[model samples]
Target: MLLLAECLNQQGKSTQAVPYLNQVRRRAGLANTTAASQAALTDVIAHERRVELAFENKRWLDLVRTGKAAEVMTAHGAKQKRKYSYILPQAYNITSNRLLFPIPQREITLNPQLTQNAGC
Candidate 1:
């Protein structure tokens, strides 16, 4: 369904992209979305991506696009702090330059226009 949604979003048809997304989830034995607005839909889609595409490289771009890159990754790989797991890895420091992911070394050297982010 993401294929359809991606196409629709690219074509500025994201609102109409709902049906296709619903269809895809149904095929995966998932229920239909209950989101009531675009923001909710975006949140739902992000959670879906995290679950359905876990272990894949989906989070980085999603984080970057939402500008929650730091917020999300800071607690990444850590289960919620509830009555469950208590320890969490410190992935990124949200208040500092550590939030800025480093540019690839190859890209930096290949293109002088590129600059390295603070923490590399």
Candidate 2:
């Protein structure tokens, strides 16, 4: 169902993606699968993927692949800080430099041509 929704959305047939998206929503106990629903198709698909794929360790990779890592994580960090005053401000900083992980020291030492990623 997610595959069908993703294909439809990619083909610019977001309306067609609705029914497939709704299938997943219905399986998750949401009964409002009517075509009259007004949520954005992409958002619906993303939400479906997040919930359906939960705890499989794919969420971070998905956010990075979609180029939404920094934006989403930054907002999430702000929400966490706001909701829990004891949280440290720097705990969830999601800067551009964070988009890529630092090269491991062992690998860099083994190959002088290799350099660590920025902000490591």
Candidate 3:
């Protein structure tokens, strides 16, 4: 199902991707996708991936791959109104450095040719 959705998305056929995405949605007891725009459809696919693949350890990588971790996480953090809110300001900064982890110091020391990643 996901393979079909991804193919259609890659082909710029978001409307066609709807059926495949909806199949997953329906199986999850959720309503079928009804997005009319490519961006909206892409969002639907990403959301389905999150719901359908929950706890398979893919969420963080998905967010980074889609370049949405900062925006989504920032918005989500803002919604929290309790003790957790205090950490939001310092957390979830979506910088270029944040996208990739810094090369480990040990690895860099072992290989002088290795360069440290930016924002480390």
Candidate 4:
């Protein structure tokens, strides 16, 4: 699951991730999603990543990269902080900045030439 998502991310194919992302759920016997239904492409991918790679705790960063961060944060993040609450965030509005990730601190330290991500 990680490999697939990483591959999608690395290849700049996150938008094309649903077919492969749903493949992750197929492992658990859920209905497999097709590119046609990837309508909620970003969310479906995020949810797929959530359980598909739950053991690795990859959803947080995945959400951020998919441009679903603020939507997830304000929606899911806020709910997560609520006591005993468990409301699912519908989905964040998608935009351009959703694709890139913040460079690692170590990498930035080693290369002053690198710039911090547009949004942190």
Best by TM-score: 3
Model 4 score (lDDT): 0.61
TM-score of each: 0.61, 0.66, 0.70, 0.48
Candidate 3 lDDT for residue 97: 78
Please tell me which model should have the higher lDDT, number 1 or number 3. Answer: 3
RMSD of 2: 3.7
TM-score of 1: 0.61
Q: Which pairs of residues have clashing backbones in candidate 3?
A: none
Please provide, for model 3 over 1-120, each residue's C-alpha lDDT reduced to its tens digit, 9 standing for 90 to 100: 865796798689887788888888888898887788877777778878887898899888888877888887767666663457457466655666777888999999999999999888
The backbone clash count of each candidate, in order, is 0, 0, 0, 0
Candidate 4: clashing pairs of residues? none
Residue 14, candidate 3: how far off, in angstroms? 2.4
TM-score of 2: 0.66
Writing each residue's lDDT as its tens digit, candidate 1 over 28-47 gives: 89998876566666666667
> Which regions in candidate 2 have their CA more than 4 angstroms from the true location?
1-8, 11-39, 105-111
Q: lDDT of each model, Cα atoms only? A: 0.67, 0.81, 0.79, 0.61
Candidate 3 error regions (>4 Å): 81-89, 104-113
lDDT of 2 by residue, 48-73 (tens): 79989999998898798778999899
